[model samples]
Target: MSRKKTNIEKEIRALKKRLAKKQSRKRKVRIVARSVISKSKTVIFDPCAICGVREATTRDHVPPKAIFPQPRPTMITVPACSECNNGASDFDDLFKVYLSMQATGKSEIATRLFKERTVRTLQRNKSLLAKIKAESKSLLVENTEGESEEKLGVLWDSEAHDHVVERTIRGLYYHHSKKVLANDAELKVQWLKSIPEEIESILELLTEQVIGDDQVRYKYYIAPEDPRHSVWLFDFYGAHYTSGYTEPTDS
Candidate 1:
């Protein structure tokens, strides 16, 4: 009986050891899974991922920054015009439709709707900004082949946000300097071809910064009814176009 008892004790000890080993393996597997998930989901921006501007730019949302109230908001993005950013409020209804589609996992439909609304908005406004550039052979013309090439329409692919930002930047640059408008415009279009890699770098940096800062809220802001007129300054130069962005201290 004593021998049998000793044998049972030994069996129990072996079972516990095996259980512990299995648990350790499971824990390791869980850690690996979590790591992969994090790497996959974390948004990484490259040289110009969100914006696509090669130099002197700030990140802008393709969906418009004003969609969310503040503090912590998530939306689609690209490098954008200060005009685009400030004017985002005008796209409230369209964005709501986009949000609905996202919630429903109807991306195809959402894409179609977004494109349609965008085209309509551009058309109704009669901005003719692109047309003016094309007709005048302005620096904003993007590219030209002795005026024989097909006039490039604003094309929005899967990377619509990035494309929009790219076009806007080209337009802004062209407007700023009529001398190299055509060359810059053409170069800008080609620049987008390599955007996938660039975005990865920008996203990685933004993520690291966000993770490092525990205090500041990383979110978009909607300007009040009357936004500052200076926002238009981005239509020409670098991101820090404003030396003074402070709100009024008191009335």
Candidate 2:
């Protein structure tokens, strides 16, 4: 083949690859629009979800309220002591700011939170903004029209992000079971880029719950026979997601 023809063929192949990837991502991540009926409650249980050692006093919003825009959707708040509640605020703030940045334009609520609330918060805290910017990554993503585009993606702060996900799962386990897991309970957390069909099917079978204007939802199944083993799937901003499994540890 001539040089020009070969280049043309390469470009065409690249275009096809980009288009397929875009469609796959959309198909994998699209949020379920309908709501599922539920009877689960964030009951004022005796002990805090976080520590299980302290008396429950304050309630902590799983995923935190800071991430949501004004007139936020229904929240999932679990019983928590003042210590666990107060200590995780920093991690919640980190989770909120970074995830909001990543979710802008994914939905009207997300857009508003990103362009208005989150931006304002970051603006007022220039140091935090600078810090986030420093950590944020510039990534190459394919756009709808098969063009490569630059995107600012959150480089999840591992310690903070893991804490948020694990905390959310623990709260959720308590939310469903109305029982507390031991502090040494083992929680294996995974942040998802997209949900696999197998996982989606499993989630569909679990008890589903939604909040945050339908932007945040999770499906969980705690083995009736074994409270120690539980499954959790968390979706945020209708896009970002995390899945986790928890069981009692030997320790």
**Which number leads on TM-score?**
2
| Residues 36-115, model 2: lDDT tens digits | 33586443337777667677789988867878888877787898889989999888877887788778878999888888
Task: Work out how many backbone clashes candidate 1 has.
Answer: 21
> Which tens-of-lDDT digit does each residue in 154-207 have in candidate 1?
322223332333333333332322211221112111211212332232222211
Candidate 1 segments whose C-alpha is farther than 4 A from its true place: 1-110, 127-191, 196-251
Candidate 2: residue pairs that collide = none
lDDT at 44, model 2: 38
Span of ten consecutive residues with least summed lDDT in model 1: 25-34
Candidate 2 regions with alpha-carbon error over 4 angstroms: 1-45
Model 2 TM-score, all chains together: 0.76
C-alpha positional error of residue 141 in candidate 2 after TM-score superposition, expressed in Å? 1.1
